[model samples]
Target: MRITTLAAAAAFAFAGSLALAAEPAQAIRQNLLALQPDMPIESIAESPVAGLYQVQLAGGRQLYASADGQFLLHGYLYQVQNGQAVNLTEQAQSKAIARQIEAIDRKDMVVFAPAEAKTHITVFTDTDCGYCQKLHSEVPELNRQGIEVRYLAFPRQGLGSHGAKTLASVWCAKDRQAAMNLAKARKDVPAASCDSPIAGQYQLGQMIGVQGTPAIVLADGQVIPGYQPAAQLAELALRAGK
Candidate 1:
């Protein structure tokens, strides 16, 4: 009886919204919550698609909803332009990711760059990750290719784990770049702690969909999971810049 009553009340609210959808955005939000009480909304904005609204949900999920809140779309939205298909959805996501990554100041990150790097990549790394160590080894090569490599601490083992403590130590070190090298080489770094962005960076990685160590974010905000050869990575960075 409880379940039936709740369902009927939600149905009634949705029916009212459908009849008075003059405020599309509000109607969408209200009806969506009525239908799915667990889903949380972050923002709603007008979309390029006529009569549809873009809904950004908590945890970085996105979707398109009908003006009347009668339907929702989960797939990518694209348009044909100049004989080519442009993925509007992907473009938006990339721009948003780029903005979030750019919000982190370089001074807080361990940076390796040539004097005249044309592009940069932000990597979420962990000292205990074997592939992350391998990736660090290729930083010099990437720098030679005119691609800057910036490191953000992401302990794959989660906060308070051994990996997180090691990362915090690296961030807290006087010579962060040197400390990073030592830690990546499986050497002990003097335990230290101060105002550091280790936790914040790790949280940012989680918000942006980082699943593992050595996750790379290109200049355009496109995420490349896993390791790539220096030559290949440089090529990709250049392409993303263009």
Candidate 2:
């Protein structure tokens, strides 16, 4: 009887490993769909921490889950031994954002680029943000100093809200650069609609932990939240490329 019990335990262990081994991608998607059907699952992969699977959403929101999908986790996960956040989710999410950003056409952005273009900086911006306006005000200086600034709409509100409408209007404008200037100057642009990529970009911002307007993304996928002056931003962008 004891021998039979040992064999049964071995079988159970083998089955458990099989489940875990299959999890990095498919299992994560399955669980996310199970949890929130409307949430678009973009990618799933293994994390450095054992028993955790990283789930990336279409809008750039990321999360970690147990191999079997029994538990769902949001927010930063930490490693206690060294007193540092594991940030496994952030690492994976950043990679995913890099891929998405690469696929985006340069024309989709409201670009303020230097004539001599040294570095490219992508900012998730909202017109209502004071700091975002301050950042926008530095566009000429940024361009003159040789840093290219690209803008992606990230209305503080989610899709279908007033903020989203405002961003959509700017995106749908005949002259987006002019619309941006008007919006930044606190003038309302006529409500316009288009099948813009603003929705997807906003989603990406959330997944990448962008909490506010003027959130800057460097070439290396390190996110700098909030605004920085033109010269300071230029220096950071240079260092990021290196």
Candidate 3:
């Protein structure tokens, strides 16, 4: 009886390892592409859940699937630890976002900073967004509080919007900072064309979970949706930097 039990356990272990192996990644990718040919996949790897796989799409959004690629889950994954529901998926996303933010060049963003900034926050802004304009008005005070503000264009109204056009103009302007200020104040910036990062940044905002303007991203990849007061946002940045 004991010998038979040990043999059965060995068989189960082998099956489990096989179920978690890397061979399923190609199948998952191929099958997913068949469903949505335009979907861009960044990576596929085994998830924390046994026999499940994590699929990271271009721009940081994710989904999960069974090892065989026959089943899919498009929601957050949680782990119950010590009676607490820990958001494992969100934690992974936060790390990924931090890495993505780190990869971006500073020159691509419109920046307002103190000579010696204590900490900085990235804001995804739409020129036509009321809340975004409100936040911009307080940038000077925030800079005074040692909080640098970096702006990335996100025309919430889609790529063809007037906001997107204005943002492109700002990017093309000889004086980007001044153009941005005029835009936030609802003034017209000279229409110009150049190789712009607006489209890319707008897409990036979508990938990073920015559904609206004035989205504040801290250094640690924590996103504060909508507008935040200068003092409060500066405090948050200081903490994240530490």
Candidate 4:
């Protein structure tokens, strides 16, 4: 889980020429499994770079491995063309976020929206995060501007912490919206427990590069990492929708 860049470089330096006859994806999986049998590999696919494959690991970590599976690069991948450097890693992550979001049902989200919403954004929020509270306070204004806000729990502390427990309570409450508001306001909601999606949401947040609370995903799968004013967010959402 914690392979240093220098270590990876040394690894590649020693084992860069092991060719494989199998498909790139299968060969990479086999190579990685041989290295660490217990490491969870979620997916493998062709990367933007020729002869390099993008590997998606459990918990959303990504790395680039050579097509032959002998070299691994543990950093961002950039596509340079026409005097510009485009972050190919981020672009791929955005597409993956879009696909994952599409699989989520609205019923699992806590939403605030106008009767006829122009667009909706998904937010990964933590109950104890100050910026998350600031963002929640603007939900009504965002709704008024015809932008729906859907919230998924991303407790800064792991699932066993008080923050996570509080989020679970919010989801268990009969009035989920009110409970969320109370938690955001730093007030305690009645402790409750149920079969909730908090754990899955937290994992999803990690996969989509949500390092902090109030991480907002716009309609086009563009990730805005912090709080934006209601009016500005509404404008951004409308533009992203188009």
Candidate 5:
């Protein structure tokens, strides 16, 4: 009788293991959606932390959930090993940002590059922002240091506003770089219209956590919010490449 009881217990344990192992990621997603139907979930994958799954939402937001989808955590997850703490969340976000940025064609950007470009940075810029104007003023110096600067429009005001119209004019102008310069100098851009990616770029900026103008995204997908001197930015870009 004891032997039979032991075998039954073993069978139950095996079945439990099977149940845990078969918990589908889709189930977790469904559970999340049930809670927040409006939240845009992008992807789900197993996290470094045991029993936790990483959930990536639209616009680079991240969260963690239990394998069974019973609990969800909304914060950064750190892995501590050998007396060092590594931010797993930031690592994942960086990779996502890199992929999204790579998908952008150079033709869509106002690019300023040196003859021998060593590195490039993408900037989400606004025409009327003071810091963006300051950053644009340093573009010549940045170009001299072999760092290409690619500009994507991100008007602080939302679509259909005056700022957006000005940026759309810049994109529509025959010489985008010249128009950008004029707009940054507070000069009125000639009214022009085209099939522009300004709105998409603005949404992309929001997804990637861009809160202000002149947000610089380095080759390594690190975002530097606000202005940095030309030399300092060049040095940082070079170091990131290494």
Candidate 6:
């Protein structure tokens, strides 16, 4: 009986070692794609923890799945040790946001770059949002401090609403930046129909989990959920590696 028990213990150790040797990147992604066919896979790789994969979706999103494909989790992932939160998922999200923002066309954006710019930030804005307007009012100050601000459309109202109409009008205007300024100042842009990228930007914002106006994307891809003062925003831009 003792001999049999010893053999069982050795077998269990060997099995545990085998599980530890398995690489997360190999097969879990294929299974996750199979499970959520519509969710485009942006990245998949081994995580800090064993038996899990860190999956970053396109448009600054993140999720996790087990190596065996038996389970999936989507939300903020925290590593708790010594009373501290180590967020591996947030790091993945930042990287994802950086990539997506880099892929945006410069022409479609309204840019305010400082002559001595040391940082770049992207803001998802809606003209009609009061807080968005408040944030825009500080753009000039932010730019003066060598922080470049890039605007992406996130109409608070869905498409065909007044906010969307205003965004579309801004895209249609001859001087895009000036039109944006006017809109932020509560002035109307000329209503001229033009094939604009307002829809695409809005969709991208949604994909990135931007649920409100004045959502700022720092250079390092970290998101600031709400409006920040110019000084604070500049500091965030610096930390974002701008």
lDDT of each: 0.88, 0.80, 0.89, 0.86, 0.88, 0.85
Segments in model 1 whose C-alpha atoms lie over 4 Å from true places: 1-22, 31-42, 57-60
Whole-structure CA lDDT of model 2: 0.80
Question: What count of clashes does model 2 give?
Answer: 4
Best by TM-score: 5
- Of the candidates numbered 1 and 2, which has the greater lDDT value? 1
> What tens-digit string does per-residue lDDT give for candidate 4 at 1-242?
35698898878866663333247778788899999998778888778777888998754468889877889898888989899999887776667677678679987888887888998899998899999999999898888888888999999889998889999999998999999999999999999999999999998888767899889998877899999988888899999877
Q: What would the per-residue lDDT of candidate 5 be over residues 49-146, giving only the tens digit for each residue?
A: 77889998876679899887889899889989899999888888877787788789888888878898888899999898998999999998998888
Q: Stretches of candidate 3 above 4 Å error?
A: 1-20
Candidate 3: tens digits of C-alpha lDDT, residues 43-147: 999899888999998766789998789999999999999999998888777778878887889889899989789988999999999999999999999889888
User: Lowest-lDDT window of 10 residues in candidate 6?
Assistant: 20-29
Candidate 2 vs 4: which has more TM-score:
4
Structural similarity to truth (TM-score) of each candidate:
0.83, 0.70, 0.84, 0.80, 0.88, 0.83
Clashes of 6: 0
Residue pairs of candidate 2 with colliding backbone atoms: 59-203, 59-204, 60-207, 61-207
Clashing pairs in 3: none
Tell me the lDDT of candidate 4: 0.86
Q: List the residue pairs that clash in candidate 4.
A: none
Model 4 — which ten-residue stretch has the worst lDDT? 13-22
Ten-residue region with minimum lDDT total, candidate 5 = 17-26
The 10 consecutive residues of candidate 2 with the worst lDDT sum are: 84-93
Model 4, which residues run further than 4 Å from truth? 1-22, 58-61, 81-83
Q: Superpose all Cα atoms of candidate 5 onto the true structure and report the RMSD in Å to 1 decimal.
A: 5.5
Task: Encode model 2's per-residue lDDT on 1-242: one tens digit a residue.
Answer: 99999999999999998776776456666767876788777667666678887777764567788877778888776565576556655666666666777677987888877779887889999988899888888888878877888899999977867778888899999999899988888889888988988988887788667888889988767788988988889899888766
What order do you get sorting by TM-score, best first?
5, 3, 6, 1, 4, 2
